[model samples]
Structures are given as structure tokens and as C-alpha cells.
Target chain A: MAHAADRRCVVIKADVHLAREGFTMDVQFQAEGSVLGVFGPSGAGKTTLINLIAGLEKPHRGSMALDQQTLFDAAQQIDVRTHQRRIGVVFQEHRLFPHYSVTGNLLYGARRENGDLDRVVTLLELSPLLDRRINQLSGGERQRIALGRALLSRPQLLLLDEPLASLDLRLRRQIIPYLRRVRDELRVPIVYVSHDLTEILQLTDQLLVLERGKSVGCGRYGEIVHTDAVLSVVHDRGMNNVLVARVLEHKAEDGVSVLEIGPREQGEPTGRLFAPLCAAEVGATVSISIRPWDIALAAAPVSGVSILNQVRGTVLRCTGHERRMLVDVNIGAPLIVEISRRSATTLHIEPGTPIVCLIKSHSVQFVGALGPGSPQ
Target chain B: MTPEEWSALLLSLRVALWSMAIMLVPGIACAALLARKKFPGKVILDAAIHLPLVLPPVVVGYVLLLSLGRHGWLGGWLYNSLGVEVAFTWKAAAIASAVMGFPLLVRAVRLAMELVDPRLEQAARTLGASPWRVFATITLPLALPGVLTGMVLAFARSLGEFGATITFAGNIEGATRTLPTAIYTYTQVPGGDGPAMRLMVISIALSFAALIASELCSRWLTRRIGAAL
Candidate 1:
């Protein structure tokens, strides 16, 4: 709880308990990032947690504070109303007021005189949608309006509770960057709750893992998923290694792009990864998603091989189950490598052992620009 | 038409309009309460509202006459205190009609409000809107079609009200006699067949027109409201 007092970093500190229809949520965590990804399975209290933070639902007993402001404190007998708390929420259903047009919905929460309507309109590209009826907009367009409406309120925090859940894959991909832009431009602390870990991984680095109404773990993905139970959730779903890489070179002739992976906090560039096709401009930081199965471990960089991406890293941890081993390799940011028991034995892999990861350029599932001013 | 017929027709329109206009606010208020709230006596309140619907119209008129008529408790008090007489007058007829028509109005509006998604209101609250603002901006407009339907239903009821108005306000030729009472009076006398037939035809045409107008209006409102979602 004292860690929540970190004035420079932490924005949300919540310790709450609620029980609904036998599913209890007695979780607690302190979120300290612009976007804190909340990962959990079904009935994991993800919605309950954010609803408490937003003041939509009250906890039976607990305290939740945003910055120095106490949102709720049962002992203190303080319970702020939802509207007065000045928090914005985009529900999974995208509950835009059906009575109002796009502009009307956007400005519904702007109680202040100068509502900062222009910024949200421009950021979400809501100008054209202003006069349109809600039914007139496409799924992607409706979500943008919902996001824009939440932003216009100029709330202290934004809770996106599965905003992308109902969207199809293409629509989901379309809305992701707009979400990133909202975080970058508004700098509002966001608690993004999602059942799909893939969306959470794409949204933020820091995560709070909740399972069965308890805080299982809270840290970077590489640290939290190492827990046996959490790893199984990831293993069953076939989680991938996501690399934030800067587009360093684009050889259009060979139809390939060079992506430099894993930007350290304050050090030299970590390693190089590559993506097929001439996608994105040089110097643009892009997310490179690759499945562990797509990567092959090697003793050294194999020369004259058709494979394009190869990086050297140390093995951090190796755990085995059912003829398979999950080798955590620190190639700058930790990446999970799925290998069979045969390869684990043949490679003699252990913690602190240096190894090379082989990945074909085409195996890079995705590559796209993050934002305009993303650091090189 | 005779001067008495003209006055009676005009008076009936006035009574119906007054009845609808006076009941509109309270009808909607009660409907919203019944739709959204649960109190200790919610079932009783609900039954009280719909009692006029299930009971005979003459019975409702008797109740109104007993309570709010000239010599009854409330009416007697007003008569002695303020020299106001409502019995055997157009005002009594309007009150009787309003009481009889309330249930239809409330039922339509309540159903419409109930159909509205609660999540929409929750979303509005998170957007910094107070509950009152949410009702003004979200609830009212979304439930507009039902409200319009209720008002038209009330208006139609008042226009054709017979038993309650006759019992409470009496069958005065010009001052208190509405269209339904006038048609009844014409049929009860000699050499009244010609006027009676004309009034009967006029009554049917007016109701038909009213129904058509209500249909057109509610459909337009429903389309406009649903177009946004």
C-alpha cells in the first residue's frame, strides 16, 4: 500500500472485495502506467475491478484511491458518486446514447465550459461522424465515436472493459492504434480489462494478472506468465512473443524489411529481427509478433540459410511439461520459446547458456507503425 | 347544425384536450416510477394505477364523483372554501375522463421505458452526467414513441368517454354535454333521429381520423428514434 504513495508514478491504488452469484473478487493492485493491461480468464472479476475503480459498482468493503483522491474508503465512509468521480468508461457494448447524434454523445460528459471537444474530434477522426446517427456508422466507426465520447469528458482515468471484444479481427486491428494514440496523446491512466491476453499484450507491457477473484501476479509479461498456473493459461492459448522493433531498412528489391528488436531502457539496441514485404517506413517503430513454434533454436548463426531473423540471447529459465519445454530467453526483452523435450536435451539448454534463435522473415505475423513520434 | 350542437361539439373537444393536457405530466411521472423503482407498496401502487383499466368505467366515475364532486369531501371543501363547483360542469367531465384514461397512458410509457437498456444509463453516468441529465438526454427521447402513443391513446379515450362523464358531470345540453352524451340525448327524444344519425356519423369519422393521425405520428417518431441506433 505504501508503494501507492509514489507521487511520481502510481495513479491508481485499489483494494476491494465483491461477491456476485458465488463469483467473488477480492483482488488488489496498484496501477502505475498510462495503460495497465488487466489479464484474466472468464469470471475473473476484470469487469468488477474496473467497475469499482470507475464507481459504477461499489465494493462491500474496501478503499480505492486515484492519486491522492480517495475514490472509496469504507472505514472513512467515503463513497463518491460515479458522475462526480470524473472517470470515463467505454463498456463492452459501446453504449452510446441512442437519442443523440455522434457529436451529442461526445459532448454529453463535457461538463466543463471549454470541453476540449476539438482534440478528441481530431484524434479519433470524429469530424465526419458528428452529425451521423449511431446506426449509420460501421462497427469500427462506432467504437471510435465511443472512444471519442469518453475522451471528451476529459476524465482522470479511462476504463476500457473489453472494448475490443465484440469486434471482428479486422475491426480489432483497426481500433488498436487509435487506442495507443489515446494513451500517448491524452496521457490518461488507462486500466484496460480483457479476457484475451493477445489484445492485452498488444496494448501494454505491464500487466495485472487476476484469477478467481485474486491477484495472481502483477508485472511484465515475461515475469508473470512464468508461474505454473499462469503459464498453463498462456500455453493452452498458444501465446506469442511480441517484439517492438524499429524499421531500420526496407529493401524493396528483395521484398524484405529489417526490424531492430527490443529497445532497452537506456542502452544500445538489443538485436535485429526481420519482417517480410516492404511494410512501414524506416525509423518507424513497429510491433513484430511471432509464435514460439515459428522460431528454431540454433548453436550459432547459420550462414547461407534462407531464414532472415536470427538473434543471440541467454536462456533465462527452462520448464518442461508433456514432452514440451518453455525456454525463456532474454533477447533484450524476455521471449518465450517453445521447444520439444528432444531439442531441450540435444541443445543442453540451461539458465545463463547463450543461444541463437532462428526465425524466417515470413513468420513475423505482424508489423505496423506505433505512433508518429515513437522513439527510434 | 343547431347552436346547441355546435356548443356541445366545441365543449367536447375542450374537455378532451384539457383531460389529456392535465394528465400528461403525472401519468409519465407515475409510469417512470413504476417502471424503475421498487418500494414497499409498489404492487399496491401499480394496482391502484391500473385499477381503472380492469374496473367498470361507471365505477371510476362514481369514485371520482364521491371524492371530487361538488358535495363530496374534496369538492365540498372547495365549494365552501373557494365557491368552486365542479359537479354537473365540463370540468367534472374532464376529470372523470382523465381518471378513466390514465392506465392506458401509463402502461404504454412504462413498457417503453422498461425496454430501454439499463446499460445506456450506466454509460451516461460514467460520462459525468447526473441522473436527471441522463433522463433528460437519454431516457425521455428514447421512450418518446411510447409517450406519444400513450398521449394519443388518452386523447382518443377522452374524446369517446361516455359512461364516466355522464355519471359524474351529467347530461347538460350545451355546457356539460360532450359528443357521446349529445348523441345519446338525441336518440332519447322524438323527432331527434335525423340529428342523431348525423352525430353518430361524425363521431365515427372523428375517431377514425384520430386513429390514423396517431398511427402516422407514432410511426414517424419510432423511425426517427430508431434511426440513430
Candidate 2:
């Protein structure tokens, strides 16, 4: 078994073209991230992409390879069976076998004499559920068992197709931590698919954006959001700038906490911003999500403002989407700020122009605590 | 009851049990094939399996005689090669009963197998189970209640079989005579009403018991599988 620290990044390359009734999915991309977030809205062929990758659906023409093994090749007629591909999939619904107990379902696909069972059971906290029947489990418990079952197969690549989509808000929060453990402890390469931008951002920054069965953008979230193709898909979806920040100090009297954000390299400039007081200890890392539209850009730092955060940075790029402009700023970190076009003209904002991003302390929502092994 | 009537009742039970045993494997096989597969002649196969149910039982018995009798085509080869006789014997009575009861067995089991969700089988396949393993583990168990219902139905039908058994095997006392055949024999004689009435009550009671047992078994199975839905 490969440990997290020694596991190399898995590379996935696919050039698929499939046409169904009223829908055609023609996407091509190569991703090398340990967890590549597949982001798009409904009917954007997100599920179809997952099916194609998992060998549940065949493409009309194209080839796909995962780390060196060819999963499918239309010309070569090298389509591997789903079971033989060793790719685990956790579908939106918890597809646990109703005829089996939780332990039976987990071991259904496990290799004989493989000792990963106990480790996986402990990792997902499945000891209490081992003897329970599928129908007896709650929705959250069922989804966790589904995840543990997939992991016990020891898949080379795990495909999560909106594993949290069917769960309620609180239940979704319950499963995200176990998913992080799977990512950070097991070190299995994952392709996390979801329409919720904030949910995907909590797992990984590398993204593959799909729109209407097409590859709109594929790269780091901060760099790809500047493109118009990506912006149009995520503009009204509550897209947020997810940052990894360290707790600096807490001002109990003011009921606010300060966090330092930006590159962690020595001597590099970092910005300080006030956020709502959180229970995390000082010096611990936490993920903060601030909606792009919640940010207001100014030409200069203004004094006596009610907004608690005024971080100055240079504009990297700016793009117009309908009546608004999405400005990318580098305040020791890349952040996408959505402001109206009127403000853009008033401030004479363009690439290379220095600007101040004014944000209220309440806008900074803590998504989750980042583990030390979590990718930035 | 006289020794002759006792033999008739015993023979009827033997014939019913034998018929059920003979048809169990092939009945479920045909039901599964009809419910799951799609071949070119599927419609024709389905129609043939159901022909005995709709046709006159006498006609079915005549057809069986033509194909499996001593001098018949298949029977002649069997007689010459293996020296085995099938017609006008107790075995012929069982065969006739099995053929007449086949349609009911297939109908019940097919409906049950069709109700077993295909998605569960697909999930099994993805979990590294082969097609045969999926059928054994998922499809067969889920369809068990229907299979039992079909078996009981076939067993009841076999016990009451008359027209086909008489035509194919003939009513020889202590050899091919069954409950209905013995009843017909009693009714044809003078002052035979008492014996005929006694056997009539027994047949009705046996059929009722078989039906009640089937209902109880089906209820238990439904409870086991209902939670999955």
C-alpha cells in the first residue's frame, strides 16, 4: 500500500466525443492533480463525464488513459470492463446493496486476503455499522458506507459524482471531513464532481469547468475564472474566492479575529483581514470562503469605513460579463472580485492597476479546517 | 376405504410430487430466460410454452403421445437405444401432469423474476461479480417467493389433472390411476357414490392445503424483501 507522503500524482488524459439524443459531450483534457474538481451546473454533462471515465458509458470516438493504463480506445477497441478497470465510483445515491450488511457491502469488491479492511473501517468510522442492514442505516450513514466500500476496493482512481448532492446541508458537512481523510490519509487520486462551487473549493483548487457538454476551462480556479467562458458559467452560481488563511490573533473585546493570507514564502508580502471570531486556535489554518460579488474595489484605501478588511493589491486581469466586470487581483494571493462596470470605469481599473478590495468582516465564512497535508 | 381406493390416493400423491420435481428446474429456467433475455424467437418460444395452457388438455395429451409414445418418433429411438418406455405407465401420468402444469409455473415465476430490479444486478456486476454470480446471489433469491408460488400451483394442478392423464397414460388401477381418474371410475359404477364422494373431499382438501401453504410462504418472503423497496 502506498502512503500519502510517498504517493505520486496520478495523471488522467481523455479525449472523448459522445452523442446522445439531444446532447453531445465532446471534452478533452489532461489533469494531474491528486483531486481535480469537476465543476459545472446541471445538464452540463458533468455526470456524463463521470460515467465515461468510470467505463459505465462508452464514447463514440476517443481514447482515455489513466496514469499509463489505457482504459478505453475506440480505434484500438481496448475498452476495459468496469470491474477490471479498478476505478471506484460513489454515485449520487448511496448504491449500497440492500441484500447485504454494511460489512458485506464493503467487502463485496475487496481483494481476497487484503488487510485494508480494518484500516478502512477505522478511517471511515464504520465499526458500529458493520452488522447493520442497508435499510436500517440513515442517509448520512449509508453514504459513508458507500464511500468506505469504494475505498476498500483499493481503486487506482475514485470518481465521486456529487456524493453530497443528495444529502442535506448538515449531513453534507458530516461527510466532507471523511472525504478529506480519504484524500489526505489514503492518498487515492480523486475526481470530485459537483455543481456547488463552494463545496468543490473546500476539497481542491484545481478545476475542470464544463459547460453544455464542452470543456470551457481547466486549470487552477483563480487563473481560470478570469476567462469569459468560465465566468459565464459561474457568474450567478455564488462563486467564491476560497483562501487558506492562518489565525493571527483574537480580539475578544471587539468580537473579531485577524487572519494572515497570501503566499507563505519567507519575506513575501501578506495581507491581514478581520473576520468573525472562530473557535480555531491561533496559528491554525482554516479555509475562508468570500463570495466574489461581496467584494468592493476602490482606487485607494479609504479611512473611517465600516468595512473591516481593506487589502491592497495589483490587478492581474479584468473581463466583462454582461453588466458586471470580474477583476482578478493579487493581494499576495489571487482573488476574483466582481464589481459593476460603472465602478470599473469610475476607478479606471485595468490590468496592472493597484486597487484596494474592501470587504465586510461578516462576509468571510469559514468552510472547514485545513489539514497539514491539504493542497493549496 | 378399500385397498383399491387407498392405492388411488397414494398414486395421486406420488404423481403430484413426481411431476413437481420433474418440472422445478426447467420451469424456473424458462421463466428466467423469458423474463431476462431477448433472442430472435423469443415471441415464438413464449407462445409455445403457453400453448398447453390455452389448448384443450386432450389435444396436448395427443401431441405428447405422438412425440413420446412407444412407436412415436422420439420414443422409437429411445426404445431402440435405451429400451425405455414412457407412455401408458405411471411415468406417463407424471409427464402428462407436468406438461399440463408447466404454463402456470412459468407464468408465476416469470412475473416474480421480472419484478427483481435490474439495477441491483448492474450494481453487482460493477462490484466484480460475474453474470452467473449476480443471478445466484441477487436475482434468484429475490425471485424465490414467486418460484415457490409457481411450484405450489403446479403441484395443485398436477393433483387434479384428468383429461391429459387419461388420454396419454390411460386409467389402469394401481399403475396410472390418480384421484380424478379414480373418481371417474367410481362414478361410472353402480352404487359408487359413497367412494366417489370420499375421494372428492380428499382432492379438495389437498388443493386447499397446497394453496394455503403457498400463501404463507409468499407472505414471509414478501416481508423479507419488502424492506429493500
* Candidate closest to the true structure, highest TM-score: 1
lDDT tens digits, residue span A282-338, model 1: 777677788887788987889999988888988999888776888888888778888
Clash pairs, model 1 backbone: none
Name the lDDT of candidate 1: 0.82
Off by over 4 Å in 2: A1-8, A246-271, A278-285, A312-314, A345-355, A369-376, B1-6
Model 1 residue A94 lDDT score: 83
Worst 10 residues of 2 chain B by lDDT: B119-128
Task: State candidate 2's DockQ.
Answer: 0.45
| TM-score (C-alpha, index-matched) for candidate 1 | 0.91
RMSD to native for every prediction?
A: 3.7, 3.5
Output the lDDT of residue B49, model 1: 91
